[model samples]
Target: MTTTFYEEIGGSDTIRTIVDRFYEGVATDELLRPRDPEEDLGPAADRFALFLIQYWGGPTTYSDNRGHPRLRMRHAPFAVTPAAKERWLVHFRAGLDAADLTPEQDAQFWDYVTHAAQFMVNSLE
Candidate 1:
């Protein structure tokens, strides 16, 4: 059987660690914290963990629960400015670093997030 990027990177546990660490950063971020209206970040973290897991090729549970990701559309409610994107990447970089994947795996994962962050920018401000 062919292994997936999810499996290659150590599956759900790694993804959860990455998401948890990312949220740890987000919890204290002024800009990012305002973006999440919820006082408790757990649900948001859970959603993100599921999304990353599915996107990286694990179970389809994210879609199963949330339907199509419609990423840009879903993110439309937020300003998503370039600065916000940069800040988002900074926290995400911490998450990636915590995962400690192989260099190639790290590069691949980073490449996707960099582009995704840029794509998420909905405002020039």
Candidate 2:
């Protein structure tokens, strides 16, 4: 049987850890902090972790709980400028760095996030 990229990277727990780390950065980042209005980051973290888990081929819990991942539409409320994308990538890069993955896996994950980040950009400002 062919293993998935999720399997290659260690599945749900790993994804959650990376997301937790990502949120840790987000919690402190001035640019990103105001984006999440919630005082507690747990809910946001859970949503993001589930999204990554499903996206990486682990499970469909995200869609099951939240319906389709209309990423752009969901983010439409936000400005999502170039600077925001860069800040987002920086935190995401930290998350990926904390994961126990091989170089290839890291690069693959990075590539996906970079593309996804660019796609999320809805404004030049």
lDDT score, candidate 1: 0.95
Please write out the lDDT profile of model 1 over residues 57-111, one tens digit for every residue. Answer: 9999999999999999999999999999989999999999999699999999999
Per-residue lDDT of candidate 2, residues 35-109 (tens digit): 988999999999999899999898899999999999999999999999999999999999999999999999999
TM-score of every prediction relative to native: 0.98, 0.98
* Candidate 1 TM-score to native: 0.98
| Model 2 RMSD, rounded to 1 decimal | 0.7
Model 1 / residue 124 / CA error / Å: 1.2
Runs off by more than 4 Å, candidate 2: none
Q: What TM-score number comes out for model 2?
A: 0.98
